[model samples]
Target: MDGLLLRTNYSDITEFILVGFSRRPHVQAAFFSGLLCLYLVTFLGNSLIVIVIQRDPQLHTPMYFFLSNLSFLDICYSTSWEPYVLTQCFKNFPTISYTRCYALMTTSLFLGMTECLLLAVMAYDRFVAISNPLRYTVIMNNQVCLQMAVGTWVSAFFISIVPIVAIPANFCGHNIINHFTCEIQAMLKLVCSDTSMSLILGLVISTFTLPLPFTFILISYIRIVAAVLRIRSTEARLKAFSTCGSHLTVVTIFYGTAIYMYVKPQSKESQDQDKVISIFYGAVTPMLNPLIYTLRNKDVKGALRKLIGGKEKS
Candidate 1:
């Protein structure tokens, strides 16, 4: 019996308890309701953009192609953890299996990183359109767009896998994750071994994936602005800014929340605040992206109307 107890104690844990949201029943109910709405909206909105982009011949340009990719990424990024978050809001300290936990973490990381690079690519596409309008078609040709899109996905997946595969789930300490989802940082808090390597790895990865991409976007926009300013017509500049404004807003919100969540120093108070900020990054941002793009872009709004009008005519 003593030997059996010792074996159990020494065994690697296979599950983790997710301490999600508030324990108050009222808060849980409100959270569940709000998150469910956001999930449904995100799924519907992003799916609509994907369908519209696929069906609308006018949106076949490289810009729309990248926008479609971003929409799809938002869908995937939200799906990686939102459902689990919804489940956790209703249930107290729900447990997720180690395998599933890591799977969610890996998927979230993959999508997040892919999005960072994809945004940069989109910014580059805009720069090409603005700075070299004469060769925009040649530069952002179908082949180039396809290559960039594939590279973004492949690169992000490999980068995400590096740390995930290196960090084994052989945790020998507390298995309680303080976040709504199986976040890498929250999961790291449970590791009994020295997590310095993992922490350093995360920091290095963040440097490359987060701020680097943001800087690239800023540079691209700067160049684009310079080119736009050279245009003599006031209407032309307004049109140019309007075209890229939605994307810029999205980049700001996404990177702002992500930088705060990952790049900021961790503390007890920040940990508590992390859950709230995470909702913006994980749930609200995805839900808002489709709306931001569709509402701001007349082309998308027209396509949506055409789609709905066609259905009605049928």
Candidate 2:
């Protein structure tokens, strides 16, 4: 196994061919148009959220502070690879250089891991707000929120590096990736080296990044529900549930698709399904987040109205 794995020289490989979608011209044109629309919507929607949060004094609390960060993450997340994907859609043979491929992979993983941790932090914020309303501000103060945001980014950066380092460096000349971007599983399939160790490391890292944070969010929500239940006023209970509904929706869409994508075993048969799922979490979710939050939350709706009104007045 060792000899066979070592047979291929990785240095000889300079680029990877991304076998993204249907080669038919009509199919490619439709895919391109669709992705372009998704990218535009994601960018504008998340940007609006960030702008609204920054300009609104009422949204300066810990919850909105975290939301601003999330919006920024979504913007960066969508921007990082969507352009490349869009460009690749029309290409007869889409190719990404080795360095560029790795860079995109690492960046995507870092942003995604940041999102996972940030969502967990947001859950904790909701938990504190619902569970200890009196001390919510005191507990999740400006300094603490800043620290949590910084810590989430820094931790995700390092965590994203782990799997990249663990992956076998040698590749057998098979450089075709079946996905649009440099998705980890798709890239891993191209490696000629023995991948058992890499697979194990990827699983362990996936557990840390996915299940642990998801479990934390689940536990936090459970407590939040318990606290909400204890509230005597029916109206108050409704408000509490309303506050969390957007976050829960976002969490369910994001983590549900992500956990399914990363945690499950990947096979050739699933590559097409994987691409569609990736679009849901990657493109559609970001596009939908602002809509979900704004439409569902009164405060955000008010802020958006004020922002639009102010702009119109100006």
Candidate 3:
């Protein structure tokens, strides 16, 4: 098995041919058209959220501060792959250079891991707001919010860099990545060397970065639920649920697709399924995020209406 795996020369592997899917022109064309629209919606929608948050003083709370950061991350997250995917749709064989592949992998991982931590932080913010309403402002002030944002980005960047340094160097053979993007799992599959260390490190990282944050979110929600239940007024309960619900939905969509893509055992069928899921998380979710937040949150809706009405009147 070891001999069979060590079958390619790493020195010759300058670029990777991303044989994304079947070569049906119609399929590619359809994919291109659909994904292009989603990309536009994602870019514009998230940009709108950021703009609204910045322009509307009403949205200057800790929640919206975190939300604006999330919007920015969504923009970066989608662009890291959407443009490449769009370009690949027209080509007969989409290829990525070694350096570019590493870049894509790093950027995607950094943004994604950062989101995991950000969502957890947002959940903690909600806990503070709902459970300790009196001191919420003091607890989640500008300094704390800024530190959390900076911490998420810095930690995720360093965590993502581990693979960039190790994987390329250890990819002793094979240059063909069997996906549209240089996803860590797909790239890992192409390595023709002993991947035990890489695999172990990846597993360790995933455990800490994925499950730990998810646990925090889960625990936060549990306490939030307890607090919400204590509220006597129906309207108050609904309002409280609404705030947590939107974040929960977004978190579910993101973490669900991500966990499915990364945590599962790789198989031919699963790999094909993962391509569709990649499109969902990479494009669809980002487009839906702003809609979810704006549609569900009255302040955001009102602010948007105010912003639009003011422009129209002028």
Candidate 1 regions exceeding 4 Å error are 1-10, 168-170, 267-270, 310-314
Report, for every candidate in turn, its global Cα lDDT versus the true structure: 0.81, 0.83, 0.80
Highest-lDDT candidate: 2
Residue range 162-248, candidate 3, lDDT tens digits: 555645334554676767787767676776566666566676787777777888899999999999999999998999999999999
lDDT of 2 at 166: 44
Q: What are the clashing pairs of model 1?
A: none
lDDT of 1 by residue, 108-221 (tens): 878888988898999999999999999999999999999999999999878888666665444675778887787766666566665566667778888888889999999999
Error of 3 at 199 (Å): 0.8
Minimum summed lDDT over a 10-residue window in model 1 is located at 1-10
TM-scores for all candidates?
A: 0.92, 0.93, 0.92
> Where does model 2 exceed 4 Å of error?
1-10, 268-270, 310-314
Cα RMSD for candidates in order: 5.6, 3.8, 4.0
Give the Cα error of residue 177 in candidate 2, in Å.
Answer: 0.8
Candidate 3's TM-score = 0.92
